[model samples]
Target: MEVTLLLEATENAFRIMEKARAHALGVLDTAVQFTGEQTRFMEEKRWQVLFAGAQRRKTRFQNFVGTALILFAFWMLLSGHFDPFHLTLGAICCIITAYLFHDLLFANVRVGDMRVVALRFLCYIPWLIQQIVLSNLHVASVVLRRKMPINPQIITFKTKLETDISSITLANSITLTPGTITMDIRDGVYYVHALDQKVADDLNAGEMEDRVAHIFMEADHLYVEDVLDAARIYDALRV
Candidate 1:
């Protein structure tokens, strides 16, 4: 009887030890799975961060290159010197200027098609030149008048232009004309000194503002002519 009881007790002890061992192995496996999932999550987050940083760097590089090229082209156009020494000097100056002020040129670059903007700007130059000539003649006529009807007056108008660059361009264009000067720009309002009432009326007509807005792709209202011009520009580019 005593030997039977001892055998029963030994069997019970062995069963308990086996169950404990199985439970420990199951817990270990669960821990290993959780650790692997955490590692993968961290790796994915790291890759995402790296990719975003790379994209930002790429955009900045493109902007810098574009700015440098534009500066160089403008320098060449203005200097009109094709000699190697002058070319090299101008290139250096443009590179330096672009490095210093690239952000200013591209600050309000909202449109993806920079080529379109450039073409539009080039087209605008001729129109601006024509306006300047017409303005000169008008000013000349005013000066040659027997009474010299020089009625200089300050006119203020709120501009619809969106960007700082566009505003500056408008201001400079006004100053470049014979009878108007951009006196101050305060809170989107332009204070201009016009040599006569006719000059003020011409500015109030908003043709110049509309053209500037079209060039920058920031027009609030598009005209039929603007749409046709844009279509023609796109067709020319495709060819």
Candidate 2:
């Protein structure tokens, strides 16, 4: 009887120890899983924060470089000095100005490839020149007429352009044309002085505004030419 009681007690103790070990292992596994999830969450958040900061830094750098290049070009154009000493001084001034006012130049700039914008603008120049020539001839004809046909009037229209650069470009283009001058721009509305009723009708046609929007990639509606231009830009970038 004593031997049997001792055997039973030993078996029960062994079973209890086996159950306790399994419970401890279960608790440890749950704790490990929770810790792993927490670590992953923190890592993801850290990566997101780092990526946002990097993007901000990149945009700032781009703005600075763009500003510097424009200022340098303007300096060269206005100074008309090609000597090394003058070039160096101009470059230094441009760099300083860019550093001080980079944000101002790009403050309302849309997010797009500057190269694409430049290429489009270059393409637009020929068309603009043609328009200017046509306008000049028309103006000359009107001025040389016996009646003079001079009915000057101001016309106001709200523009769909989203960025300041596009708006300014459109304004300048109008002023460059012989029959029209951009009097003022306020709250996205342009006030233009037209030399005659024909000029006013042409301004109301909205072709110039559309072209400006296309150059800046700010158009809500894209023409076939605009689509082709965008496709070409994309392919070039991919290469």
Candidate 3:
């Protein structure tokens, strides 16, 4: 009789432990599912806020910049430094340009990307630094040589820039370099006039392409700035 009683007690304990284990696992699974749902929800909300904020800030900045440009034109008009109509027209042009390239001349506006356009100019500051350093050395070599070793030539090269902005930026950067002046841009490729063989070599280096790519990267679009595509004439036309 006692043996049977003990067996019944042991069976009850085993059943209780199994039920406890299953309940704990169920609780853990529920917690994990809840955390995943919450994480996704938060991420979606964060991106929505970020995009909306950028739009608002961009619009406001454009308007403020536009107003400043227009005001400067007004100041020019008040100074009576020439044709008032021309001044007015110039101001209008400035406003239009600002609206077109909002980052350069205007602020906070939903107009076209002025930031990338601005970046092109900002990038020149560094390029100018390089130019100052390089041109001096280049000029010294020519001066020290008994006969001028400079072999000035104009060469054409194609770029891989997909957007008009990036292509323009790359062209401007080339021109800003002491030895390389961009004479023209055909389609997306640039025709560069080099002061010497060294200039031609630098143009061939593709370093400028990488820098321009970095500038475009700061702006928020891929389609307009990637100059690394193999198909672009810039990549194919290196002389």
Candidate 4:
């Protein structure tokens, strides 16, 4: 009878141990799944944070000033109203527009010194105008010719321009020039329709791209140098 009782107790203890082991395994599995989910969430959050920081880094107060000036100038140029009441109204409208849409207007504004960027852009305008005139003359000559030399074709080229503003500027410049139109821009690739081979050749040469790149490159280099200098100064102070 005692041997029988001992066998029964041993069986019960073994069953209890098995149940406990199964429960422990379930708990571990749940913990591992929960940990994995949290890790993924954290990774996503980190990317969001990094994206936000980059966006912040690309914009500045100077962007607002630049946007306001451009808007006001455009308004004045269009309205051509110099009267006090009209001027006041235009100014108010420009301020409101600038306040509301400055970020969008200067979405890729350099975080560097605005004065240098403005000056460089101003210098680029005259050269762009010259190109437009030359293009216009070419297009006119083609149109007036007895036999049309028109050979319409679409050309696609990838650019290394890092800023949305620079890419957009290049696209607009292409559109402004005669015989070539910017059809679409995606993933740093430009789709352009050329009226003739000359336009295609000019675009393929990438002069406009180089000019736009120059506008931003010097400012970006200076900005990076400024940041590095600031960091060094801070470190020296700490020491």
* Highest TM-score against the true fold, candidate: 2
**For model 1, what is the alpha-carbon lDDT of residue 118?**
85
Clash count in backbone of candidate 2: 0
Residue 152 CA displacement from its true place in model 2, Å:
2.5
lDDT of each: 0.76, 0.78, 0.64, 0.73
- Choose 2 or 3, whichever is better by lDDT: 2
Per-prediction TM-score to the true structure, in the order listed:
0.63, 0.65, 0.44, 0.56
- Compute the lDDT for candidate 2: 0.78
What does each candidate score in C-alpha RMSD?
22.5, 21.3, 21.7, 23.0
Clashes of each: 0, 0, 16, 0
Model 1, residue 61: distance off in Å is 1.1
User: In angstroms, how far off is 89's CA in candidate 1?
Assistant: 8.4
Residue pairs in collision within model 1: none
- 1-239 per-residue lDDT for model 4 (tens digits): 54345545655665675576567556655666767866656655665676566445434444556577778788889998899998899889988887888778766465666667778789889988998898889888998999989999999988777777778888999998869999998898899999988779977866676667667663243343443453444335435
Q: Residue 58 in model 3: shift from native, Å?
A: 11
Instruction: Return the TM-score for candidate 1, rounded to 2 decimals.
Output: 0.63
Model 1 over residues 10-109: C-alpha lDDT tens digits? 5465557557655755675566576786665675566567657755665566566768777887898999989999999997998898789877777766
In model 1, the worst 10-residue window by lDDT is: 230-239
Which whole-number lDDT from 0 to 100 does residue 76 have in model 1? 88
